[model samples]
Target: MTILDARESGLANGGPSFSLGNRLLRAVWIPVWRLGAGWTPRQLHPWRRFLLRAFGARMAPGSDVRASAKVWYPANLEMHEGAIIGPGVNVYSMGKITVGRKALVSQGVHLCAGTHDFDTPLFQLEAKPITIGAHAWIAAEAFLGPGARIGEGAVVGARAVAFGELEPWTVYSGNPARAIRQRRRFADDASNS
Candidate 1:
């Protein structure tokens, strides 16, 4: 393979260190979260709501977690004021996950925080924190992979996979999620004018 082809291959799948930690984190977290999962059954929305509240998910008053949404670890997830984790969204946070104020994680979106390594003896897993900045919108069916750091006011378009950092106020989409364009401005001064 040419140098360019090898480089492309590396970009698609990360290196050994990255892979190792992701796998280990997932192995450790899944069972721990699953143990707590029974407190909130698949259909029991109210029960789930209470469980999340018991954990340290700092939801502001009146912020809602829809029934169909699943939080793998309520204690490890933090949602700021006015954040909406909508229906059918799965927050699988083996690593620390934070969603800033007014961020919207729409329906069927998967926020994944862990992956496994192939190089290690045990196939060690690596985990990286996922952060969605304030006012960001993760549209329907979008997936935020490990180490995804979505910037403030950014929008990941429907079905996008944000594998890395996203620029603030930018719109992104596609498999690895390239920046599409700057989001439209809606300044307070413009409204006044």
Candidate 2:
């Protein structure tokens, strides 16, 4: 329950969250993915998609992953059609991450599905899934923490950190990502005008 208790339990008993084979797979695939998939031309989406898919990612056609974006584990990632992961995005998907259709993850965004339990001496790994719903927008420099969910048409403003679920058609901002306003559906705008 406490750090002291964890220390008394012994570090030898505590182990990595994943298997050795999984670690080895990442060791081999990371460099290759960085070199090949991360430096390719923006137009070469299929090639990049192929690389991700080969490593077990589920991505639909027309989903754009920028060259500079980093995915920690492709096996835990899923992107639906028209999803866009912009430049400098880091997806640390230790657990499942699903991006719905037409979702936009802007530049410098970090989607982190893993963290360490600070209460323990060994710092046991804690992981949870992240979901970005259809037409949701995670703006530049935003951070989506473990178990965060951005609902359909929601927008997370620049530099915000989402640690909980966002409501559909809402706009969020600030460090902990508070709801600031309701988002209007773009499709309804033309009719409203």
Q: For residues 1-193, could you state the per-residue lDDT of candidate 2 as single tens digits?
A: 1122333323447655566666787897789788888778889988988889989999998988888999998888999988989999999988888998889999999999988777867677666789998889999999999989888889999999998789988999998899999988877322210
Best by lDDT: 2
Error of 1 at 63 (Å): 2.6
The C-alpha stretches of model 2 lying farther than 4 A from their native spots are: 1-12, 188-193
lDDT of 1 at 80: 71
Task: Show where candidate 1 strays beyond 4 Å.
Answer: 1-49, 186-193
